[model samples]
Target chain A: MSSTHIVSIYDEELKYLSRRISEMGGTAEQMVADSVRALVSADAALAQKVISEDVILDNAERQINEKAIVTIAKRQPMAADLREIMGTIRIAAELERVGDLGKNTAKRVIAVQSSGMPRKLARGLEHLAELALMQLKEVLDVFATRSVDKAKAIRERDDEIDAIYTSLFRELLTYMMEDPRNITPCTHLLFCAKNIERIGDHATNIAETIYYMATGSQPEGERPKDDTSTSVVTADVSEASE
Target chain B: MSSTHIVSIYDEELKYLSRRISEMGGTAEQMVADSVRALVSADAALAQKVISEDVILDNAERQINEKAIVTIAKRQPMAADLREIMGTIRIAAELERVGDLGKNTAKRVIAVQSSGMPRKLARGLEHLAELALMQLKEVLDVFATRSVDKAKAIRERDDEIDAIYTSLFRELLTYMMEDPRNITPCTHLLFCAKNIERIGDHATNIAETIYYMATGSQPEGERPKDDTSTSVVTADVSEASE
Candidate 1:
């Protein structure tokens, strides 16, 4: 083949990979939103849908990885082109994880379906999910636009999700303590919330990948963190109850 | 440059990537073991050490990635050699996440530190951790030996970790419901167990990667999964109590 023909084929291959990433991102985003909605509304059907749809993201990741390896072998891309391909691989992996977290959340719906979540607790979780979804959406856009500035902004915003998760963690523990009946359902909700919190972290991971793809270096400094529930000790039951 | 000199350099590059992966594997294994020991014994100092050591794995992943990208750009390897390079990248990422799960488990040590976990609960968690660590070690060995049969075996054994984790999940929830005082520490232990289970999952992931690197095709059939904790509903507190 002529050099021009080879170049066009390579370009088409790259575009195909990008389109796949975009499709994976959309599916991941919807799964996150739908999982949280299922939790809040106790919609088993939606949760089941999210669970089955996860294979789409899983397959997308595997296909992108196969295509990426093929492109690298055939094109022997160097420098910027190589970085873009590597970035897609990493981004696709992250989105696949995001899908896993969503499926995990949906899987818990069955556990809480019978007991039903309290509105107050559901509201707290909903608020946290919204922030996480916002972060996910913004970072996916950054991936598409290759905007370092917005990516940086999304990285900083992760602290918001962490903070919300910490608070919700405390609330769930307190509720579980207040009534033994709440233990099983609350445990499931806590995991679901943790799943959403991790979704936010994946978005941050994608942002970092975008930065590396564009600038050829990792983001400066450590990513911010505020999820302190790990060290939290509710020693005073009375205080927690109040 | 002579053709032999170029070949040797290319060989050296590939060797360096393998050594890095081995180093990463060793570190991740140690982290998983140390974190579980810290949790079982409530050793804050050991937990702190595990937390600090995570950066080493993170840096190793980044360095391996950089070298692999350069090797591909410089050597332009094809077929099996290219698959080997991509395999290293995927393996490094999995090890990095295993390190993260270990670090997250270590972070929870403080929450259960003061209260001191119940001996029975600790034993249950220890049992689960042992299974997960065994899985991790086996998979890392498979990565080194490139044994497709061993990889397939490890993939099947994931169900063992999942089964143990599901039992542990029920035990922790039961402990929490039996006594309100156990709520705070039990919650932390629950998450710790979940983290270990995830470590096992990463090991299975590594096994799959090793299989792909060896055969250029994904393993047949869906992976065996028995972690029914997601859908578990302990509605009858009385039943859980017994």
Candidate 2:
């Protein structure tokens, strides 16, 4: 942003777009934290609040997209400028998806209103939430500062969230097996845990975007894919489809 | 794509992007079908083929994105033209994610190599795959034809996939409970089912993009959300976070 340009208003448009993205990042972070709280407490009211707040995140994304498109039309930015603007659109879209994940998680607070969640796993989920939110915050900073190193660090931490999620999946399975009663509520937590895990993924996606925007080169090498959710298939057969 | 323009090359550029997107969509649909074949047949080699083919989809998306941005920068397309290019970008991105889902589903073929999957569930997954691919095929046609009505119809069908997924979830859970040994494989199928369901979601997203591009207006009313995953939360209390 500091790269001096002849047209000051071009700079202004970019700055305004950045500000909207910042607002979106902040809202997404709050939505994550609040959704977890509502989940743990089964506070439907708080869950409702998280749902309503998603509109703000959506609005923020719209503003950023509109401004970015208009700026592109007006400035006809290429290479770095185009990448920078496209990066905002990508980040804003990721943030909005995060908002949806939060809303979906928050909705779970009301979904299991009859049976209580496993008390023991509450700490585990909170720990996972802390890890994901930390990642979200760090990625947002990377976006603001255009720090490739910071973006890479955030990208690497996505595995830690996945690890936590993998373990939680087993624990929930055990709970369900030990008592049939645990099945209903634990399944809810399972999906919610996956939601939080996916939030970490969005952060990683943003980190990649920031790195590409700054370097004009995508970070090389495959992203670490440690989520063992893939290991669930086995022997079966079906007639082939044309 | 057929509208004659003063700059014939501009039309050509847009057509090329569209052709790439169509290729991507076709490849993604094939990947889904192949992944299911691998899953049902427990054919790791076929799964590997599906996994390997994903690069084609990814490369298609990248090509479309780069070309679209360049066209916009050079053409400075406004209104419908701008929306057309942006829509291609959005659709390609969605197609890429669909490819990822297919790859992940294919990977499950390798993950479940240790044990045999339930024979009963293969049909369930194939059914889900059929529905999703059908939706994908229909939506791509909508994009090609620029038919908002077709897009709207595809959007409404998303709930049907969700409904099928919810039932499949129950069926898998029941299978797991009836036999503890079923847990591992059923869990894998559970993730696979969700992945297929998510493919339907990407199709719906593409439909929305088509709707917007054709009409220059986002469709009104809430998207049908019938996934029973939302009904899992209940009463609980824990120390809330700041």
Candidate 3:
């Protein structure tokens, strides 16, 4: 083959890889939305649908990985092209985990359905999910556009999700402390919130990956983190003592 | 350079990749063990060390990833050589996540330390961590030996970790329900336990990767998963009302 024809074929393969990533990103985004919708509406069928659909992301990741490896072997892509292929692999892996987290939230629907979840708690969870979904969507967009600035913005906004999660963590604990009956439901909600928070973290990771892929270095300094729930001591013995 | 000379250099590169993976695995395993020990003994110092040491894994992952990409570009390795390089990248990512989970466990040390953890609860967590650590170590060994049978066995054993985590989850919920004072500590401990469980999941991921690398196909049948904690309901309103 002529050198021009060889380069063109490589370009086409790269484009196909990008398209696959976009499709995978779209599926992941839908799963996150539907999982939260199922949780808020107590829709087991929708939740089950979300759970079953996770395999799509799994299969997508596997295909993308195989394609990237084969492309490298065939084209021997170097420099920027090599970085893009590697970034695709990493981003696909992150999206797969995002899908997994969404499915996990869906799995909790059955448990949350059995218990009567309070509107306040359900609303809190919904809000967190919305934020995480927004972050996921934006990062996916960043991946498509290769916008380092937007990626940095998305990275910085992760603290917002973390802050919300920490507050919700405290709120759920308070509910659990207020009534023993709330423990089962609130515990599940806490985990649901946690899953959403982790989804946001994955989005942040994608953002960082995009930044690295574009700039050939990591983002400067650490991304700000505001999750202090780990060390929070909300229940005082004297306060809870009757 | 002669063809033999070029092939030998590629072999050396592959060996270096494997060595880096082993070292990264060793650090991840130690981080897991030390984090659990810190939690059990309330040793903030050890937890701090584990937290600080997580960067080593992070750096190792980046180095391994860059090295693999470069090796592929230079060597254009085919078939099994290509799969081995890809497998190394995937396993490195899993090990990095294992390290993250351990550091997260370490981060919980201060909160668990303040609550005066019950001996029984600590022992439960320690036991769970032991199983997870064992899984991690065994999977790393499987990676080195490329033993597909051992990898499959390790993959099958994940349910044991999940079962233990579920029982621990219920036990923690019961303790929280019994006394509001236990809420904060139990919540942190619950997350710590979750982290350990996730470490097991990562190990399982590594085993699957190693199996795929050896056989060029996934292990058959769905791996058994026993973590039903998501759907578990332990709080009975009637029982608690009295």
Candidate 4:
């Protein structure tokens, strides 16, 4: 084959790999959304689907890695092309963790379903899930378009999720205190909220990654302060009450 | 200068950059530890130190990025070296976040110092702080040694911390229920526990990154399921009594 032909073949392979990783990100986002919904709706089948679909996400991660290595070995890509490939690998790994978090959410839902908590709690959880899913979606959109503006907006939403988490936590704590019987279900709901919040955090992580990839600068945020007051005082009353 | 000499200079620059990032990691780790101690002891000066030292961490991140760009543009590193550079950039970013979280914890300390809570509560929080420090130390050790086994072990400790958090949470809740006035202080403690827990989580994330750098495999350990039946029932009973 001509040298040109060989370069073209390598180019095709790289493009194919990029598309695959992007598709994987899309699927992982969907799984997280479904995992939350299944937990909220007690949809056992959807939960099962999320659990099983994790294999696909896992496979995609493996494929992205293999393809990158093969391309490096054969094509010996340099400079910008190499950065793109490495970025793809890093993003794939992050997305894969996001998928695992989703699967964990699904597993928790299954466990909660078995414990038989009231359905009302699930409705509140659904709100948290929606918020998380929306954030994830926005980050994915930024990745697709490489839009720094969109990434910045998504970063701001992280605080929103944090605020929602506090309220959700208070609500669940109230439920558990009202009825010991509510503990199992409330705990399940709490985990669901946590999963969603974590998903939001991961979304922020991805957005920051995107920001770096595009602008080569860290996302601007006020340096986080090292105060224990908010956390300590919050726990103190809860401890006293308990 | 000869091309060969230029190549050597590039190599040296990359090495220097790596060493600086490593030093930054060490400094950030120390800052986090000090911040936690400050919160536990209410040491205003140490808290101020943590906040000030964060400037150094920020500068290290900026230097790493600048060096990576210079290396990429001037030397045009090949695939593996390129991956290493990118990985360094990403790891530095994660470490920067760890530093910010530490600062956030320290800030909370200042915010709650005047809340008039018992000093004993700091003991529980101190435990969390120790756990986070240990995790951070382990993760950095794994990074330095590239020990997959060490990374795996650190991953397990995440679960242990989670268990502590659960018990501590219950204890705090009980305290709040016992005296309504304890609510404010208890809430602060809860946030401290959470920040420490999150720091531990970030440490685990770094461990996962180390694993990826070493073996290209995602770390093990599924997310734990939430089991809150006992706590829920106890909470309910406590509420009824109130």
Greater lDDT among 3 and 4 belongs to 3
Native-referenced Cα lDDT, model 2: 0.82
Ranking by TM-score: 1, 3, 2, 4
Taken over the whole model, the C-alpha lDDT of each candidate is 0.90, 0.82, 0.87, 0.70
Candidate 1 interface RMS = 1.0
Please state the error at residue A182 of candidate 3 in Å: 0.7
- Interface RMSD against the true structure, candidate 2: 6.5
Model 3 chain B: weakest 10-residue lDDT segment is B233-242
Model 3 interface RMSD, one decimal: 1.7
Error of 2 at A117 (Å): 3.6
- True lDDT of residue B2, candidate 2: 45
- Candidate 2 clashing pairs, residues 3+ apart or interchain: A111-B233, A112-B233, A112-B234, A113-B234, A232-B188, A233-B112, A234-B117, A235-B116, A235-B117, A236-B40
Off by over 4 Å in 2: A1-6, A111-115, A232-242, B1-6, B110-120, B232-242
TM-score of chain A of each: 0.97, 0.91, 0.95, 0.83
lDDT of 2 by residue, B1-242 (tens): 64466479888898898888888988999999999999888899999999899889877877787788778877888788888988888899899999999998888776655666666677888889999999999999998898888899899988888888887877776665565455556666777888899999899999989998887777888877746656632222221100
lDDT of 2 by residue, A41-107 (tens): 8889999999899889877877787788778877878788988998899889899999999998988
Sum up the clashes in candidate 2.
10
Per-prediction TM-score, please? 0.98, 0.89, 0.95, 0.73
lDDT (Cα, tens digit) per residue for candidate 3, span B1-242 = 99999999999999999999999999999999999999999999999999999889989999998899889888878878988998999999999999988998899899878778888888989899989989989998888889999999999988888888998888888888888777888888989999999988898899999998998788998976646798887548546323
Residues B1-242, candidate 1: write the lDDT tens digits: 99999999999998899989999989998998999899888899999999999999989999999999999999999989999999999999999999999999999999988787778888888888888888888998888889999999999888888888988999988988898888888899889999999888888899999999999999999887735789878976788989
Q: Which candidate leads the pack in TM-score?
A: 1
